[model samples]
Target: MNAPLTSDASPRLEDFPYRISDNVRFADLDPNQHVNNAVYATYFETGRVTLVKDRSHGLMPEGLSWMLVRLDMHFRSELRWPGTIEMGLGLVKFGRTSVTLDQVVFSEDKCVASAQAVTVLIEEATRKPTRLTSEIVRNFQPWRRRGVNVASPKF
Candidate 1:
């Protein structure tokens, strides 16, 4: 399991290498008038999916796909509508078949939520876990989170 991001020490958005902006839709609000908790998961997913599925980045290889194995999120503050959010993602750890990522959602420079997600590489045809290829691991180096010492990927 991954350690949760504590309130006393919140992460900076700059620490995340990959970032994208999204709007807070009115439909995302709950009866309480704040972005629903479930919507935050979609925000995090957008960050991860945009990074991995982008072909120019060379993260995804043919015949292989990534599967989400775990996600742990922490909501810090209330996110209201009529605003845009900046989502960030950083690769923190690399395993043989899985990669751990730290993701965040920021509104007006304030971190409203954060999460740690684990995704495993799998063979598309067999639907079985597959070891990360060396090329794929190397491609991920540029997306690593700042200040975290991600060890070299082991084949």
Candidate 2:
């Protein structure tokens, strides 16, 4: 008889190779002296932009643009000022015209927040969602969510 596996092979935040860092500013703090809640969204945006531009894996088209459709976030801990926020980004779901990305923000080596965002690739002329090219799909396959086998149905 064989023992069942104890460890799960699911992908985690650390599985994402893309990294983005930013320093919390005094202006980012509220009366509580912690980073404002709204600033978390900006951090995630910076991660996404960096993944698509600075650290892009050469999958996306040169001029590809995105339209963020929705963002579901959870704030786990307070982020203090004068600290660095290290963000990790991963592709949680891929669709015909959109992609759902999962991100986690770390401050002082602690996870402060996590978010899932749906962003659609849009055509500049029509301002509408466009299908992902085969090349892009191939390039993103290595980063697909570990347990997800199919693309998400919704944008």
Taking all chains together, each candidate's TM-score versus the true structure is: 0.95, 0.81
Q: After superposition, how far is residue 144 of candidate 1 from its true place, in Å?
A: 0.3
TM-score computed on alpha carbons, candidate 1: 0.95
- Candidate 1 lDDT (Cα, whole model)? 0.93
User: Which candidate gets the maximum TM-score versus the true structure?
Assistant: 1
What tens-digit string does per-residue lDDT give for candidate 2 at 1-155? 96653222332556655678888889999999998899889989998887766435765576677788998777888988788888877787788788887778887767788887889988777787889877766676766654545464442
* Pairs that clash in candidate 1: none
